[model samples]
Target: MSEKLGAERLMPNEWRDDLEALDLEIVRFAIICQVKLLEPGVIQRVLDNDARDCIHGNQTAFASLRGLLFLHFQMQKDLAEAYGPSDATEIVRRVWAHLQPRVGDQLGSLPNPGALSAV
Candidate 1:
């Protein structure tokens, strides 16, 4: 008799989709970060909260996160140039508020850190 493979053992395209989804999450987070940066008070609050601790400790992960941060900064700069710095922050904040929950859901679907570490 042949043994049956479980769903976990079966390869699925969901993994790739999940990764792509993660990229989108990072983009969304970056946008929020940009909005937060626009307000010195908000940026100070975020730094005081030590939110960086949530990021992965690995160098590659850090670099990837930094890249996303830079992307958001650039996006903010572009918007400011086009729409005026006075209103760019508000626009970013609104866009981020819409994107945040979707990103959170996608991130929540990913495997936990321990599972990734085991691999």
Candidate 2:
């Protein structure tokens, strides 16, 4: 059998760390969107404005916007797959219920260790 298929080929620590960081950032973004500090649609408006500019903006700007949208949709897919489909309100409730204890006083929470397996 190939070494790549062997148990020793488990993911490297750096990749694991990167995944953890991404998960934390995703959760933080979600929390920020929930807080009332920003008016509703403010985020969407910002993204839309950037997107408009990207039409004539440099490649880096377009790539940045594309990356952001990819991450956004990826989070949505992960949430649905992890918690199942439901109203947005119910999904938010489930997300917090899963996260609150794990995060406690922290600004944001990482997924429960090993929760990434499903993701």
List, residue by residue over 9-113, the lDDT tens digit for candidate 1.
Answer: 322333233333444655555344433222223333333443453343344444455565444455555545655665555555455445556655433332322
lDDT of 2 by residue, 19-116 (tens): 34554554454344332112334334334544332224454544444455456446545444544444322434444456557656443233442222
Task: Give the Cα lDDT of each candidate.
Answer: 0.43, 0.41
**Pairs with backbone N, CA or C atoms under 3 Å apart (clashes), candidate 1:** none
Instruction: Give lDDT: candidate 2, residue 50.
Output: 41
Superposing every Cα of model 2 onto the true structure, what RMSD results? 10.3
Stretches of candidate 1 exceeding 4 Å from the true structure: 1-55, 103-119
Return the TM-score for each candidate structure: 0.42, 0.30
- The weakest ten consecutive residues by lDDT in model 1 span 110-119
lDDT of model 1 at position 80: 54
Report the number of clashing residue pairs per model: 0, 0
Task: Tell me the lDDT of candidate 1.
Answer: 0.43
